[model samples]
Target: MDVAEAMTLLLSPQGRLDPYPAYERLRAHGPVVEAWPGLHVATGYAVIDEVLRDPRYVVSYEPLPQTTVAGWAESPAVASIARSMLRANPPDHGRMRQIVAGAFTPRRVAALREVVTAQAAALVAAMAERGRDGTTVDVLDAFAYPLPIGVICALLGVPEADRSAFRTWTADLTVVLEPEISEAELAVADRGAVALRDYFRDLVEARRRTPADDLTTALVQAHDAEVGRLDAEELLANLVVLLVAGFETTTNLLGNGLVVLLGHPAHAAALRDNPDLAGAYVEELLRIDSPVQVTSRISSVPVAPGGVPVPAGGEVLLLLGAGNRDPERFADPTRFDPTRPQNQPLSFGGGPHYCLGAALARLEARIAFPLLLRALPDLALAGEPRHRARLTLRGYATLPVTTVTRPHQATGVEPRRTVATTSAERRRIARVSAGERGTPTGAGPGTP
Candidate 1:
């Protein structure tokens, strides 16, 4: 396939199934290829890295809504997402990031290894129980969806009751993140945005009344302690962004990693035997099949990624999935080998706007996968797994599998094994609305 045909498939619903072939074809056209006038698609590892790291290339999602309709800023979702670190550039992004990052340090994230382990253990045990009767279980609906939401809610101090609402909120926000969406989709996203923003606002007020040692309390303190640390909008917006991003990226990682690991039983056994391999395993998994597939940036001035010139204000679609699989970056790019030393995936992105909950996401996968393997040693794919029909965020909508419950044979993965995964799993209504977007970076990274 030529670059045009490749780009076409890469953006289509069919391409979402597996864009690797098209990525290869795109890379064949050199690192940066102009797909249209004033638009480019970047496919090289080094070049995309350079663009991500360069401050000259800004996220620039502020003016995107103006193209859709008048007073687009009136929409809470647009304002909340656009205002957060997800889209902010230099000074604003830096300031907002410092506050959130400080609260979400590596030490803090590492502390959640226990939370991840405990929750994952329970989820896996439940999955085994559900499939014990020879019933095929949807891993995405059963195990993948709940683990990340539980951890994020624990960290954010959101009550257990309110956690269920996040599924709908996250789904709506994700649709909004797409480059091309319908007016109806936009309206759904707008309503979700408003709901999420209001929820956080109420949450902040509650924290003020009864502060707890959680992320929300920390943010509330930051806002109340300083004159201009975090205003109402920025605070609420960041809170909403963090929760959605935290859940979205990690959920995809768990689902995607499960399918990848189970496909290669040897690697899954390796992880079951030695959990330390999880970091490398998850890294390789992310490199081969990234959750956040594409991120874009606009040139602040005349810039060239791979000697291909991009005029000021031009947008470049950074095919992050392509970069991760670049032949120059990794030997035998298509293969999934965890042994590769010094592995770094473009999945979490880089530079100033890197994912704030990246450590949290990694920690969740690093802990969850081992427990899953140990708990479900006989787990095998029970049916044809379905991938979520979306371009930017790649993951499973339903990953079916079956296994016998080894209650007496295997020890409980967690100390307290009472939490049951019996909650109603909501089936996501898959929608595909692809059209020409006026600005390439529609909503900031679903992960960013």
Candidate 2:
């Protein structure tokens, strides 16, 4: 298949379920292939890396023009996302990044290591309890969704009780990032954005009145400082960005990582045997099946990536997933090897727009994965996992997993048999169980 046909398949629902084949077709065509007039797609590692790091190829939302979603640009959600560093360029991006960089320093992220480990262990224990009686638990809800949300909320000083609401708002609001989102999804996203902004407005005010040892408090100070590093609108928008970006990507990473680990029990056992390997294991998981599959850029000036010229203002989609699996970049690219040397995946992106929460996301996954394996050694897939129908962000909507209590850890409770007769019924049961347990039923969170 050619690039066009491959891209068409990739954008379809079935294509998303297993885009590797489509990615391979695109890569085989050329390093950089023009998918449409004035629009290019980078499938090779070298070209995608160059495009991401080159200043000439900038984020598409630099000027923050009207979105394809009619009337959405005027919506609070769009406005916030527009102002965020994720979509900004040059002065605005630099300023926004610098303002919050202090809060994500290595020291700060390291401090959260304990928090991530604790939260992961707690969530895994709860999941094990749910499945101890032989009941199937949706890992996406029982574990993956809650761990990152709880940690990010703790970092931002968001109340624990409000984490589920954040999950809901972030999930809906993320649809706005989809390139071909429907009008119905756009409306829902707008509502979520407004609700999130309002909630943050109140939270910021409270933080201003009573400062705490959290990133939000520090941001409040920055906004109110005599230097005025950030304006009120910038503060609120970036806060929303942080809250959404902070948890969403990591949540997907955990879910995707677990799916991969469960699929390869040997690797899962290796990690369980030596938790320290998690750092490398997480990197491989990221490469083999990245949570964020693709990102786009607009040329600020005439530039060429892989010798394919792109005029100023032209757009290019950087296929990170394809790049990660580029044969030229890594030996036996399709193979999942945790010990692969110098493992580098575009999962967290690159350059000035590199995900600000990369360190935190890695820390969460590195700590959470091993802890989860240790806590639930007998974990196995109980039903067909349901992947969310999202193009840009990919992860499970329902990952029903069963765990058997070891003889030594038996709680004397009989396991409940899962009685769903069909995929739809299983999904319904998972959603109902998630709701009853006060967990987020949808995909956990989303990143840019």
Q: Which number leads on TM-score? A: 1
RMSD of 2: 8.5
Local accuracy of candidate 1 as per-residue lDDT tens digits, 293-339: 98889998999879999999888999899999988989998888999
Residue 257 in model 1: lDDT: 85
Which parts of model 1 are misplaced by more than 4 Å?
61-73, 413-416, 420-447
Clashing pairs in 2: 133-415, 133-416, 134-415
lDDT of 2 by residue, 38-118 (tens): 789898998888888998877874446544667765767677788777788878777667656655656556655644554
Lowest lDDT 10-mer window, candidate 2? 437-446
Query: Each prediction's TM-score against the native?
Result: 0.89, 0.88
